[model samples]
Target chain A: MTTARAGALLDRLGRVGQFLWSGWAGLAGLALFAALWQAGHERYGDFILPAPLATLAAGLTIAADPAAWELAGQTTLRAVEGFALAAAAGAAGGLAAGYSAATMRLARPILTVLLGVPPIAWIVLAMIWFGSTDGTIITTVLVAATPVVFVGVAEGAVTRDRGLDDMARAFGAGPLARLTTLGLRHVAAFLFPALTVALGSAFKVAVMAELLANTGGIGGALAAARANLDVAEALAWVLIAVAGLIAVEYTLVHPIRSEFERWRNAARPWGVKR
Target chain B: MTRETTDAAPSLTLSGIGHAYLGRTVLDAVDLTLAAGEVAALVGPSGCGKSTLAHIAAGVVEPSRGRVARRYRRHGMVFQDPRLLPWATARANIAYPLRLLGLPRRERRERAEQAAQRVALDRADLDKFPIELSGGMRQRTAIARALAIDPDFVYFDEPFTALDVALKRRMQDLVIEAARGARFGALFITHDLMEAVRIAHRVVVMDAHGRGIAGTRAVPGKPGGRDDGTVYRLVAGFLSDDPLFRHIHDIDERRTP
Candidate 1:
């Protein structure tokens, strides 16, 4: 009955509409990518690169098998677990580094070393340590992805809006409250980008580690397909891993990230007409 | 000469307040005082360190060379920017200080709504994020947040410099109305002489380079209900007669994009 209630409902609806509209844009962009893939297929032919439609058929056929589903599930679980652990450790380490100068000085060199070392090297070490198990895959993913997240979050903390911090201090906000409200939120800006990179790396490292360690996952399936010299099956497994990564990104990571970033869409250029 | 001390804390007192950046002096020997329930406006040109003084007076910045005293249970600061957390709703932003005070969720929400009402922010606007609200609305949210804690003192550091003429006056009225019976003192910083004359009990002028006070003009009667003509006349007298108010207009002109 009240206008305020009505306005609130309208604003919520408007936000939902904006979200779906952006989703459509994302789909449209994917369609363009599919079109490019189809062009590549036409040039390279079926042996080198399958047609987009043919690849879709192959992926569907592979998905119909329950064993393939189990393999896909294993790979997804490894990637997600590794990402979760890395996120926790990296965010904690980065916040410490950001909040304290001594930590930053100590961490900067170590992070640089970790980041500079290749994932292949880590996967090789994990294979020697854990010996052909999920441990090898998860360890490789964590080592590969943690520094990426740590660097992003640390930079975000360092560059947080000091003006906002002053405003908070004036309002009698204690140290902990300020860290949660202003400090963490500022880091959220950088957190999402780092997560995107970490997510991709998690999947890549998981698969690479699995293939090296001969653990059971999509990577194993790809190795089997390669041994059989079956181009379609190998491509199908690759497509399945990518789809899984994308699903987790959309369903898990993105919704939370969008909540924090909704404010960014509202900052418009001055003097620009609506 | 104004190295003042009091056994009991007054609203605010600063003497011989000076600041410098990397051996370059930005302010020197600036003295100011505000009584409880009184509002004093510090008017100066841009870069004159009026803001720096407001910061020192509010204890946000330690004066490089001065003794400062503040006797207030709680202090509020309204920055030039609203500085609302973009991720937070207006209600959340307004309730932020109360949350710091460790009030319950329901009580904080209630106080936030009450403060929003004081600033004439409708319930609908309270639910909007700072970005969704207009610039004036954001500033009002900032004001509401500042007043929600019921502070004994407020430092308004050029908080109304960004509003349109109509919005600016409305906000000024909200401020004066809020301060009327609250008994909270305020240090209002501005480069606008008319604005200072309209809202402040007294206006302290800081000249360029911020070395010392150029002049202090006491506004007759209370802050509100003074005729626009009277305020205008007083402002005109300052511009021509006081060297400090002369460049007040120049600061206004140079920064008017």
Candidate 2:
């Protein structure tokens, strides 16, 4: 038993090593993107597009200020809060609609209407209601992100294996037991990708709402830089915003998603471990 | 009930069971009974609603009209697809019903291991997911899952139809051995006369239109006692000489009402 436990630990270490080793590919992709930015910088000159290194330098300068960390943290907190609310609400609603034909019929038209309204329009409405507070940014982000999660979860629940459901029933599992044991696990596959998309939009919508509502965050900094016409600072704030997004996605979302979908990795061929 | 009376009562009984899909009838007036420790194979052509009947009997489907009385203490089902949860390890899948029964984690693990051993699944393979296991291994895991609950009655819904010939034979032998050793009653649904002959004490044929059962024939000996030659000869005789099997292989996809 000790040896088996040791073996499992080694296996986990190897997987972690593999995950880190795969970072080279991500780094290469980012390098190619930086190279493209450099090309654009040379073509348009400093005013239109600053060099990638120069933007990085400006981003570093902003990072030196403790106040700027608060700004970035503010935006991060709002986006994460919005994402949590959206995930909870969407998953609950999606499960309801997925299981009940009547609920699905009722929710479909409402979902279409929600999706039809642009985030900007919702931002404007939120600005009037909540007025330059975290609520406006969070509300806009919630509206923008919820539908994506709802649709993904619903699709997951709808496409769940009836065969497994029947198997559980035959084994004497009650409705609640079946949902907890089988239903949630199946829905996780569909839920993860939807959550990734929702999180991305949550951050984007939060920034937009912050700027429109005159709330202080990365977006407000960008507005200030725009007025000053400091293209480097504006670009630096943009970079910082994107970096924040990547950090949260990798640290929080992707790890949780991978945990849920570890079986899918086993399904892949050995040569295609990533 | 007393142990004597319980032993005498049928493990499962279905009477006047009828089912429909939307408005179309799929099963009608199906009355069947399984005595204690009896393995009965219900055979029919494709789309003849034998699967539906099994589902109804297992209480997985609500029949439009019927009464189902399950006297068995507990039951398990093996589906045509194996129906192992894709996300769970083979061990976890085997332990699922036990978990539902609120067995402690330690006992669940112990019983799941024992059940896996009965199906001849490797201990190492228990940690692997369904995707990592071969088709045969997955089916074995499904069987192991069924066996884990220590059920008195089992529902086999074409469990080995997807396996190749040699593999099918091995699985059949596995089921035969499991039934004999465990002494659990089973309702095995299948389209293969050879399979039915190999694994069951009696073979029940369903009507083509799902109106009701057509007939039943008792096999010559107990399951797992017959040799290959006897099984093959009996199946061949039934296919060629028996009127009950005349429409067994018939299929027309457009014939569904």
lDDT of each: 0.84, 0.91
Q: Model 1: residues >4 Å from true position, as ranges?
A: A1-70, A100-113, A266-274, B1-9, B15-18, B23-31, B65-67, B207-215, B239-257
**Can you list the residue pairs that collide in candidate 2?**
none
Candidate 1 docks with a DockQ of 0.54
> In candidate 2, what are the lDDT values of residues B1-257, reduced to their tens digit?
10222346798889999998988998899988888998999998888899999988888989999899999988889999988988989999999999999999989999999999999999999999999999999999999999999998999999999999999999999999999999999999999999999999889999998999998888888898999999999999999999988999987746846
**Which candidate has the top score in TM-score?**
2
lDDT over C-alpha atoms for residue A133 of model 2? 94
Candidate 2 CAPRI category: high
Worst 10 residues of 1 chain B by lDDT: B1-10
| Residues A1-274, model 1: lDDT tens digits | 3786797689778766766667877888889999999899889888888887888899999999998899988998998899999999999998898888899999999988888888889988988999888889999999988998999998988888888888887776668888988899889889998999999999988988888788989889888888898888888888888888788787777777766776665565543311
